[model samples]
Target: MDVVLASSPVDGDVGCWDLQTGAEQMRYRSCASAPHGLASVAGRFLASSQVGNSSSGSILYWSWHKPQVEIKSFPVEPIVSLVSDPDGSFLLGGGSSGNIYIWEIGSGKLLRKWQGHYLAVSCLLFLDNSLIASGSDDGCVRVWNLVSIFGERDNERMKDPFLFSFQEHALRITDIVSGFGSSNSILISSSEDRTCKVWSLSKGKQIRLITFPCIINAIALDPGEDVFYAGGRDGKIYLAALNATCPSNGKFDEYIITCLNEHSKAVTCLEITKDGLSLVSGSDDGTVRVWDIKSQRVIRVLKLRDGPVSNILLVQLPNSTSNLERVAKLPSLDKNLDPTGTLTAIRISPLNGPPDFGYCSSRLMLNAIKELKQRSSVGAMEMELDRLREEQRVCAQLLQRRKKLFDDLWRARIDTLLDDDQ
Candidate 1:
């Protein structure tokens, strides 16, 4: 039952296709759909965000094998992005007013609402069950620690409120994806600035910034985390290096090794499969294309009349054990996606210990030494402060005694002057 689901640009007509065969399954009439605003709600249903000229922003859920919306809810503001937890327990919506709204999937109840960005939230995704990665129009990609944001906070000062805020993109952020680098530390972000940047979480900085000939709207990572594909307005998909920290053998850091020439217009959304073998890309041309990653060529194309394909999803359901027989199966990947084409892939590599702050060992040691020295001097400084306070108290007492003595002496002088006058 694995299928590729997509929405049309006009009035939200949803269509499904068999992933393995590229055969069209069924078509559903969408009430409406936003750009990059579709997400598969587990394997049971699909969720999409829609904002039309006459209708308010709403989230609509569609059941499999049906063309009508199953459930729908309206939010206060126009929702631009949507995502749900892996278990389908909660769904999150990014609004135009810079707020993120979470709702319970079963009951459609509002779970919590918090401000996630300034101006507007352009993209969002669940890095895992615990972390939510968001990209904003403010030109930043931020990682929100779900545990800290929703868990206990009894005076723990939130250091760097966001798990991490990537400020590499100077212009409005078009898309951001993780799971490309290790430990969710690595991130890929595209912008209207015509650049796609690769970040290292273990390194905590921009490992490489690949500039494209046109503005990049969407990005997808290679399965091995070695290369990433960027879809730009120029109708070209470029492959950029990920692990190349510096230049290779004196040459410039391999920016774009190759390009996939396909769509004639801007590429809006991109999705790679769990096996990392194939990729699905949607464009403004109202077509969905599946390409073999190794071949770097389009193998099948599902042309649609939906103005343009706003968002795409490759849904892979977990296999259930059979009582009759047990067979070999492929491993599921740690993949990430957004409701919109502005994707944020989150693949958190197994962190052996604590989080890496991307600081050099030597610099960290120096800071540790300085911190120890400061810690050791704290007691001495506290004592010195106490001594200063005691000295000030003693001076105040001495001044009080002198004032009393002067007053008494003045009174005696006045009495002697009065006697002389009599």
Candidate 2:
């Protein structure tokens, strides 16, 4: 399978690398400023936006197959985030100005601009063909109706405002994601307040809140939709289950079971393949690691020459079905079935494609287990710290009340003494 890693250089250019061959596929120098947002459509085209420079902010669309000429340039504000529709017909760009612009991919025409947010729109996600959800720095998530925007063929303008606005986060929403699991639509948002919240999109109410130790940069959900992965600024990756129901007392337990601690820097982006067999993680350390989800180990580490990897994507090639079938028939090693010295299918072939690096290190597994224990201990300590902070706040409020009460009593006593003197 071919994987693509797109990185926004700290200096200037945007670098795209091929993961399989560890080669520099292409570099685009269109963004005079640093590119903060990147999105791909139809697995053959990409759109990138500059972080700042409102007047000069532009989105560059380029073809991945050719990688030579630019497809089109759409002028918009410095885009903080971008997301393409599932069908790749429409591309949505959101900027720090709290405005969302929709563009037609094939025609390169601006369809409509969504305006209503009072602050910057931090994140955007296309829920379905007729609906879109946006989270903003104003601490509210607004669900927009795409049907109303494009209903009139003569005038393709957004006539109606946001359908519903829900206030959940007390801080800016960093990322918003939606998943369909168990016949339910679950929307999750990570924020700068060190908390991740899950909302029911249909009901427009929050169901659960997952708090973390540090600021969450990004979140990824498994294809099975049973688990969610969150990357924090503390250089830690957390895995939490979504099957746990909310509690009656309006409190639920969100625990992190597994942590990937190989990277020394923050994990910027994460993506899971369509089959959900593998996961790819990009870090500020300028390295991308492909992980085996079942084995819980790193399969391959692709190091980049310059700049940290801002995003990592797993694109299935055209001939993936045949390749997958060939790989599946290689061998099977079932020791339990061959206990009586029976020959197994794996024994027939002494050599395979490449050595399984995931299983080669028992020491790494031991260290990971050890670190997991340490993190659990640290998490307990963090909880204790939170308890102490809450207590301190309560104590301060009590102290202020007591001081007021004492002053009142003292004033009353003084008034009595003045009356006696009179």
The best candidate by lDDT is: 1
True lDDT of residue 7, candidate 2: 60
Location of the lowest summed lDDT over 10 successive residues in candidate 2: 341-350
TM-score against truth, every candidate: 0.70, 0.66
Q: How accurate is candidate 1 locally (lDDT)?
A: 0.68
TM-score of 2: 0.66
Candidate models: Cα lDDT each: 0.68, 0.62
Q: Give the per-residue lDDT of model 2 (tens digit) for 1-422.
A: 46565564454445555555656656655533232377765454556665644354555655454443354354545666677877665668776777777765533446566564778777777776556888888878877766545543433234546656778788877777788631136788888888888886544567788777788878888878788888878787778677764333333244555667777798877777777887777788877777788987887787766677676555543332222222222211111111122111111112475322111122443455567567787755654564466569756855664564355446656755776799
For every candidate structure, what is the RMSD over all alpha carbons to the true structure, in angstroms? 22.8, 24.8
The count of backbone overlaps in candidate 2 is 0
- The list of candidate 2 runs beyond 4 A from truth reads 9-36, 52-55, 72-76, 152-160, 181-184, 245-253, 317-422
For residues 1-422, what per-residue lDDT tens digits would candidate 1 score against the true structure?
67887886578578788988888877878655766578876554677888787535777766565677665666777888888787665678887877766664433345455676775788887766666778888888887755455442321234455656888788888887888322434678888888887765544457677877788889998778888888888788877777664344432235677778889888888999888999899998888899998888899899775578878888863343221011111111111221222112111122485322121222343455567567787755554564466569756855664564355446546755776799
